[model samples]
Target chain A: MAEDVWILGIRMTKFGKHPDRDLVELAAEASMGALADGGVTMKQMQILAWGSIMSGGMGQQLQKQIGQTGIPVYNVANACATGATALRTVIMAIKAGEADFGLAVGVEKVAGAGLLAGGSRGVDGTTWTPRGPVGAVAPLDGRIGTETMPGVFAQIGLEYGHRYGGTSFELFAKISEKNHAHSTLNPLAAYRKRFTLDQIMNDVMIAYPNTRPMCSANADGAAAAVLVSDTRLRTLSLEQQHRAVKVSASVLTSDPWEEACQVLPDVNTLTRNAATQAYEAAGIGPADLDLVELHDCFATAELVHYDNLKLCESGGAVDFFNSGATWRDGRIPVNVSGGLQSKGHPISATGIANVWEICHHLRGEAGDRQIEGARVGLAHVIGLGSACGVHILEKAAA
Target chain B: MAAARIPLVDYLRLADEPYLVASECEECAARYFNHRVACANCGATAFKEAQVPADGVVRAFTIVSFAAPGIEVPFVSAVVDCHGTSVRANLVNVAPDPEHVRTGMAVRLTTFPIGTDSTGTEAIGFGFEPAAD
Candidate 1:
């Protein structure tokens, strides 16, 4: 049987613009902080998995800055799922018995970076490049259908409303209001101010039914984690073992064919598949999750994900939100870290950052936003390249 | 002599009976707007050119009010279900507002001027407009 893996330590830099700091600086802070937290050194780590979207050889560059241990490195980039993908790579290495201790880190510096071009790797600059059919010099986004993230997600939310009645413009805005309200408690969030419903509603509309506040705040940040095999974890001090959180389930899934999924990336089915697999692996259901930190890239995404994650009955997302179950004090509090709305989304960093949030609560380290007596938690991220990752964690026993 | 006109996309036919072309997977009949090296659904390498019906229903839509620099906003972007195949396009010939457009609205393919070049040639793009029910 494969050995179980536990998160020995996790650290996330404050999620906001660090204009002066580049990717390496941000990554070094997170990596060194995680190493210190784990009470380990770079020489002790057997492998390193680094995740980032910016182009460059990050792992080797980081190794030079931190230490030249000559450890094997796996540089990963899976859109927004890069962080989770990197962490999962380390977990797989540990399970394969390649080495007992490993480190995973994700970082990105996207502050002031404008709209995302739907998941396509096409060139987007002042110069027109001929790539797609027809040799079009520019992106077909505003000209044809919108391949922009805001437009894509806006259509998705509206489509969900059209299929499942009872969803309206206000409901989606209310979800954003909830996330913005929660952001006040998270000091590391990029935008911590709470917005009134009117403020969120009347804010400059990016897409119909989705305003500026409803969209995620793009920022620069990094998150890192240290993983240890169960055998190694047992040999550690009692204090370290007690603080370690068990990796109950780690799953990643891509889009499955449905009629219209090609046109609209199937965020729903992929997430459902990941959540189902995670539940089976963890041997627990959504009800068992004390808190959750899901990818709320947009407020519209949060509501649909509530249903996709099976947090509520089929087509019960609106009611679930209405019941206030996703609030900090609700039945199953979700995104108490203000989510991507205010907490900021640094792309690659978001995945490990989410796991970092859950580990804090699991270790009783989450300060004001902590869910009291929190035990089991889940972190979910869906990159529109159509990849979804779900990680479930369990608190260590005293 | 008339000015030359070009279809903005390769799949759009500018012939008398203008219609969109899709690469249909021979195995699962999956259709793709762009050229596909292989079938995403069945991994089949075989495909055939399939003409898409001009008429479609609005399955979903959004009126984008904000956009990247140099791109106009407040346009109606929609996913139209055309004879089982989904096509992404902008909705035209109607008010770009919720009160004017809605899901299930019938629409038909139309063409509009994208821009004109120094050679007096015009580039045309495709869109969907409200069809008389």
Candidate 2:
């Protein structure tokens, strides 16, 4: 494929519930910041790919709010990985010579929605039962509805505990402790308050083994990225060049049927497949990555990703964490931006937020969270079931 | 009995089968799921349906506590593979105790209900449980 697609700017809103801002308003603020950072007007954008998980409108309303004129605007909704999917679409369009400049924006405003509603129906065309043991829905029945993301992830922790000889308390606590510590440093994080392992272990259980803190908070936020082809980048003034980060590769994949039980179909094997493709496309391995942003909606998801992304071998993620391989000052410095665990998961906004964080790292502008001398970075995101998108970026050479 | 009209065919199919249902190119032997209008492998819409085996080893799994609506708390979700076909589904019928579940253990398909939509119907679905001896 073609190399050297430059990111002229990146921006994100503070991730949390914003009652005053609707989805469109949240997306607009980030879009404005990105446009200003890129020193480009909205009129110059050749294409707009808007990604949102549950924005009521399919992003046409969002585009209008952002003052997007008569450009080809495509709306994408890919659950949690929506942002990365949007970015991949932009990159693919640019590679196909479809556009010189592209914009990818992800936004979510999740509040007031009942958690136990709106699950994906089953193959026999039956709706998944919501949370809580009520009526005939026995606690032992496997047919619980979509409200089970946290419950599903908790099982991951339990399995990890079984394999590593760690207690459920130890495994889940380590993940919470690490991310909570990381979040304390992030001003924009949802749960800035840190928790002790004792607290995590003893906290009220939302699921059997998963305590409240072990889960991600649903919130409202938006993130945006501006991509320009190499041909367009060459025309930028010298001052504008200083802010650019190059896109090394972008990859997306869906899950196979068998992976559903191993991990979420969209995220499990798809993440690994996408990461492999991204690594190959970027001509680098996981070892070359200076930093990373992962979809840690639950503490267990982050631990599993340690193996799925090949940051460690299979069944070795716990040891990797215990060795401090994923810490900010540790080997790879994963989630230096404070992953979904700390930063809050706004669903669609999360994937773009990862990208935004990576761009900030590459531009050397990530402030206290910056990885020193970082040249290469990776961003990964996954939606419900096997849909996933991964992107690799490098600091633009001067 | 009146014939039941499936609420959402694609959604139900996904929930029931839990397999990435795609076509493989006869020319390239490349496999794809999600009913690709055309083969991503060799650009041919004409292809054969391939059901990836649902018996893969556990690559990774997670337990989600703070689930969205319509899902229960403390349910086990995992990624399993049978051959090259990978799927993500709920781990079912095992004891609620965490000690009983293993990553590399064998699993198979079982039916369950996801939820009814605004129509207020009982929609049944499918999930994975530990394979029986």
Best by TM-score: 1
lDDT by residue (B62-95, candidate 2, tens digit) is 5445444444655666656656665555677876
Q: Measured by TM-score, how close is model 2 to the native structure?
A: 0.75
Q: Which stretches of candidate 1 lie over 4 Å from their true place?
A: A118-131, A134-139
- Give me the candidate number with maximum DockQ: 1
Worst 10 residues of 2 chain A by lDDT: A132-141
Instruction: List where candidate 2 sits over 4 angstroms from the true fold.
Output: A1-3, A56-58, A112-147, A157-167, A259-266, B1-133
Task: Please write out the lDDT profile of model 1 over residues A126-198, one tens digit for every residue.
Answer: 4333456546644577777787788888888878777887878899999999999999998889899999999
Instruction: Kindly report the interface RMSD of candidate 2, rounded to 1 decimal.
Output: 8.7
State the lDDT of candidate 1 residue by residue for B1-133, as single tens digits.
Answer: 9778777777788877678988899999998877678898899999999999999999888888877766677789999999899998899999998899888899999987776666667777889999987
